[model samples]
Target: MKNNKPDQQLASRRNFIKGSALAAAGFFIVPRHVLGGPGFIAPSDRLRVASIGVGGMGAGDVRGIFSSGKVDMIALCDVDDTRAKQSREAHPKANYYKDYRIMLEKEEKNIDAVSVSTPDHMHAVQALMAMKMGKHVYVQKPMSHDIYEARMLTEAAEKYKVVTQMGNQGSSGDGVRQMVEWYNAGLIGEATKVWTWTNRPVWPQGIPWPSTPIAPPADLDWDLWLGTAPYKDYVGNLVPFNWRGWWDYGTGALGDMACHIMEPPFRVLGLGYPSSAECSVGSVYVGEFQRGYFPDSCPPSSHITLRFERPGKEELEFHWMDGGIQPTRPEELGPNEMMGDGGNGVIIEGTKGKMMCSTYGANPQLLPTSRTKDVSLPQTEYRVPGGSSGHYNNWVEACIAGHGSEEFKKLSSPFSVAGPLTESVLMGNLAIRSYDYRIPRTGSDNQFDYPGRGIKLVWDGANMKITNFDPANQFVKRTYREGYSL
Candidate 1:
C-alpha cells in the first residue's frame, strides 16, 4: 500500500506470472510439438496470420503461408463455403467466418498479418484495411482494381510502416535475379524495346454479359462476394472463376498475366511509369453485317503499346500482346524453338544485343539461345530461399522480423516495387478500355461513334490522369458501393 510503482511495471510482473503458468500447464500457448523441432521458432517469434478469400487461389496461398511453420493460422474468412472447403479442412482449428469485416474486428488483436487472395476488385479494400490496422499484408497480383487504388496502397505501406508483399511469386525467382545480373553486367546493352505476350482469357471474353440471372449457391454469400464491386444479379459461371473477363470484377487478361510476364523487363531496365499508351482490340461479329460491341466485357485479344521517357536516353517502347498474339520472332532465335514458355514470355531489345524469357522471368536467354549456356556472370542479386516457390515463406519470415528489418528490405515484390509495376500493367487496360469508349451519335438514338478509338492517351502518372482523353480518366478510379471505401 505504501509502495509506488508504475502501472507498466505491475502489468509486466502480472504478465510474467501468467506466462509462466501457461507455459507450465501448456494451455493458452503454442503446443510443444509445434515449437520443438531442431530449427524450432519460439512462439513469441512466430507470425500470427488470418487469411481472407480462403478458396481457389486463396487455398493455395493459405497452404504456402502455413507451410512456413513460422506462422500461426489464427482465422479464416470467405464468402463461399463451397470454395473454402479445402482451406477449412486443412486448418480445422482456426476460427472461420464469412465476413472479413467481422473477422478483423473480433480478431484484430490475435492476427499480426493478413493474406488477401480475393478477386481483382476486392484486393485493395481488404489489403488497405489490414495495413491501416498496422498488420502486415500479402495481397495477390495486380495489387488493386484501379490505378488510384494501387497508388494509395503503395503510399499506405510507407505511412503505416507495415510489411507488404504482392503475390507475384516470380518476382522472387532465380530467373529474374539472373536477368538482373546479366543486364547490370551489360549482357544486353541499353534496352530500347520490350515485348511481353500471353495467351490468356482462357475464360470467356469479347462477349455479352449473360442475360438471365440465377440464384446463388446455398452456401455462397453473393452480396459479400461482390464486395467493392457494383451490385449485379447472380450470374452462373461468374463465380469460382471466369470473373477475369468482366470489367466490373476483374482487370481482364493484362491484369491476369502481365505482372508475371512483364516484371523481368521492368526490373532489368529500371523502368517507371509510361508517358503514353495506345491499343487496338479484336472485335466479335454479332451478325453477318454487325460488329458486336460489348463495352462491359474485355475483348478477345488486344495489342497495346506503351512508351516511357528517359531524360537522358532514347524513349523505351514496350509492347504487350494478349489472347494468342505475339511479336515477330527474333532473327537470332531458331525457327523451330518455342517462344516465351510456348504461351507467355518476354523479349528485351537493346542497342547491342537482345534477351528473352518466359513468364515469371523463367528460362532467361540471350537472343541466340546458345548464348544462355555460354555466357556467365557473377551473381550480384541475393536469391530468396526456395526461389519462386519460397515466396510465401519470405513474407512470413519478413513479417516476423518486423518492418524496417533486413528481411523486410529483401522482400521481392514489396508495395514500393509492386505498386508501380501494377500501375504499368493497369495502364495497358486503360488503353484497351479507352479503345472501346463510345459516344452517342449527334442525333441518332442507336448508332454511336467510338471517339476513344484511334487515339493515343497521354498519361500524367503523378496525377493519375489522362490528359488527352478525358473519357479515359473515368477508368483510373472506381466508385465503391455504399459500405466499402479505400
Candidate 2:
C-alpha cells in the first residue's frame, strides 16, 4: 500500500513523456475508439479524410463519403485543375494540391484516411503509400492494374495494420446479400456456371493511337496523371474518360464495369482463383485482308471463360462477355421479361435453379419472376444502412473504429476480398492479351504465328503466374516507372 504512491507518480511521468512525443510530431490522430473502446467514443469525434483523383467517378466517390457526414474532408488532390473544379468548389475548406506526393507529405500528420480513385495504373501506388503510413485507404475498383499490384495491396492492408476497402459499392448492397442467402438456403442448389456481361467501351477502341500529340492543357498535369505509365504527351480524348480503351492506362470494358456486374456471382458462389482461363476476342480488319491489331489498345469485344475449382463442389464455368454482348436467356423466364436489367447483368445457373442480378447486384430475381415473388429465405448477411449507397460510410466508420477492430472486419470490399476478385478480372485480360500476341515468321511479308491463340492458360495462383503459358505471364505484373513504385 505504501509503494502504491510511487506507482502513481511513475504513471504521471509516463503520461508526461507520451504527451511530449506527440507534441514533437506536431499533431497525432488518436481515434476516440483507441482512447476508450468501441461504444465509448464521443459523438463529436470525426475522421479526417483526404481524396486523390477528385474528378468524374472519383469526384462522385468523394461526394458520397462527404455525404456520409461522419468525416471531415481535409484535402483534395488531382492532376487536372479543370477536372478538380467541382470538388474544390464543393469542399472549399479543404487544401488543394496538384501532385498527390506533395499532398500526402504535407497532410500526413492530419489525415486519418485516404480515398484513392485514380486511373488503374495509379491505384496501387497511392493506396500503398497511405496504408504504409497507418492511414486507412479506400481505393476505386478493379482494385489494381496488375495481378501483382492487387496481391501487394491485399497483403499491405494487413501488414500496415490499417483498415482498407476497395470501392466496389455493389459489394455492400442488399441484392448480393439476398442472393447469398438464397444460395445458402438451397434455392439455387449448387452453382456450376455463371455468366456476366456489360455494354461498355462507350469510348473508341480497336483503332491505332493518334500519331500527333497535342500541347498539354494549362490546367492538366500530364506527367502526374500518367503516374507509373511511360511518359507520353497528352492526347485529347484520353482524358476526362476515354483512357478505358488503352492497355497502358485502363483495363478496358472488363475493368470499366465488371467489378459492379460480376460481384454477385463471385460472392454467392464463394469463389476463389480460377484453375484455367481462355478467351476469344472480336477482331477488326485494318484493311481488306489485314487484321487490325492495336497492341496498345484493348479489343473491341471479348468472350472469356474461366474454370474455377471448388474443394467438394462442382467446378464452375464462369463466362465474361463485354463490348455490348449478352448471355442466353434462361428458359424459366417469360420471353418479355428482362434478362439481367438490359445492358449489364449476371446469371448464375445452379443444379437446382437459376438466379440473376443487374449491375451493383440491384434488381435480383429468380429465373421466373413469379418464383422471386413467392420465394423468401432467412436473411443471414448484414445489410449496410443504405444498401449499395452505404459503401462509403462502411469505410468511414471502420476507419473511426481503428484498424483490426470488429468494425474493420465488417468492411464490404476490404482488399482481402477485392484483391482476389480483381485478380480474377485481370486474369481475363491476360487471356485477351495473349490472344493478340504475334510473332513474325521468317521470309514472309506481314506474316506471323500466333502461338498464344486458341490455348487455355493454366494459372498457378499461389505463385502469381501462368503455369502452362509462359509468354502470357508478362501482364501478371507491370513494370513501374522509376520514381513511382509500390
Candidate 3:
C-alpha cells in the first residue's frame, strides 16, 4: 500500500503552494514558484484515469472528467456489463472490463487516478487499490460504508499522496460557501441546534422482508457486485440503482442523504464527529419494511439524534428525520415566515437568528423577516462562483493544475466533513439493529433505560472506535470477503 516516490512528490507540492492572482475566465492560476515542485503534472501533459463501477453515478463522473480535457479515460470497470457497455459507448476511446482488479493490473502504468462511483460496500476497497498505485481519487458521497472505512480511506490517501475529493457536489455550490461565510461572521451567533430532514420512506417501505433470493441478472457479475460484503444470493432489487436503502450494500436513509443535507452545518460550524448518537421511532412501527435493494430489513421510520461538544462554544445537536418527520420551528418567529423544513434542508437556530437552506446547499434564505434585514455576511475575496455543472469542474480544474495549485488541496469538504455525518447516520442503522437493546446516554445522570431500544452510543473518533457498546462496534468495519481485506 506504499507509493513512496509519488508521496514524496506530493509533499514537495504542499511546500510550493503560492500565487493569488486571478487568471482568464476568473479561474485562479498559480505562478511557477507553485507549479515547479514535485507531484506537479501539467494540464497539457497527458494523465491517465480509470473508472470503477461505471453505472448510474459512475457514468456521469466519467463524462464530466472527459469534458475537462485534462486526462485520458484509459479504463472503465464495473460489475455490470450492461452499464459497462454503455460507458464504452459514452467514451468510445476507453477500454472496458468487468472486474476493476483486472483493469488495474493490466493498465496500472497508464492510470494516475480513479473515479469510484460504486455501491457503498465497495468504495474503500476500490479506492484503496487506486491510492496504493499512487492514483488520485474522486469517490462518491457517503465516502465510506462504515466508520472504519472512512478512517482507512483518509489514512490511505495521506499515505499515497493522492489528491482526493468526495462526490458531494453540493459542497462546491456557492450557496454552501456563502453559508459558511455567514456562520463565521456570527450571523447565527453561537448556534446551539441544527436539523436535517428528508422524505425517504416512500421508496422502500410498505413491503415486508424479502424471503428468497432470485437469479442474478444476465448483465451482472453478481460475485463482483458483492465484493467485500457479506455473501448473499443475487436479488433483482439490488441491481441498477435503488441499493441505498439496504444495510448490506447501502447505509440506509440517513446515509443516502445525510452527506448532502449535513454539508452546510459541517463546513460552517466546523463540527467534527459527534460524541454520541441515538434513534427514536414510533412504537407501532416495526421492521415492517423490506429492503428494496438488498435482502435485509429496516424500520419503517425513525428520528436519529447526534450530539457534539464544542468547548467555548455552543454544544451542537443535529437531528435527522426520515419519512417526513420534522422539527417544530421556534414559535416566536412571527407570521409571513417561510421555513425550509420539508424533506431535505438544514435549520440552524442561533442566539441571534435562524437560517433555513434547502438540501444540497440550494435555496438559502434566512428565517424571520427581521434577521434577513439586519444580519450581514462578512466580505471575503474567495467566493465559490455557483453554477449547475456540479463538482465535476472543480476537481477537473485541480487535476489540470496538478501539483502547481492549491485547487484540490484547498478543497476538503464532503470527505473530511462528510465522514462524521455519514458515521452519525450509520448510527441510526445501528440503533435499528439494536432496537431491543438500549444503551445509556453518556454524560446523563439517569440510570433508566431510554423509553425505547435505541442507541445513545458514544463515539471515540481519535481511537476510531465506538465506546460503551460492543454490538455497535461490530458495524465500525465490515467482514471483508476472504480475498479482499480492505
TM for every model, in the order presented, reads 0.93, 0.92, 0.82
| Clash count for each candidate, listed in order shown | 0, 0, 0
lDDT of 3 by residue, 86-160 (tens): 688877888888888898889888888788999988888888888888777888877888778888787776677
**Candidate 3 TM-score, C-alpha based:** 0.82
Cα error, residue 219 of model 3, in Å, equals 1.3
Expressed as tens digits, the lDDT of each residue in 229-328 for candidate 1 is 8899999989988999999999999999999988999999888899999999987999997899898999999999999999899999999999999999
What's model 2's TM-score?
0.92
Predict model 1's lDDT versus the native.
0.93
- lDDT tens digits by residue: candidate 2, 1-486: 356988899999999999999899897888776788755636555788999999999899889988876778899999999999999999999999988888999999999999998999899999998888889999999889998999999999879888888889999999999999899998878998999999887899888999999998899888888989998877778887889899999999989888888888988887878899999998889789878879899999999999999897777899999988888788997989888888889999999999999999999998877889898667789998898889999998888888778788888989888988999999999999998888898888889888998889999998998988788999898888779988
**RMSD for each of the candidates:** 4.8, 5.8, 10.0
| Local distance difference test, candidate 2 | 0.89
Off by over 4 Å in 1: 1-37
Q: Where does model 3 exceed 4 Å of error?
A: 1-46, 205-209, 282-295, 332-338, 369-378, 385-390, 412-414, 436-455
**Relative to the true structure, how large is the alpha-carbon lDDT of every model?**
0.93, 0.89, 0.72
How does residue 220 of candidate 1 score in lDDT? 97
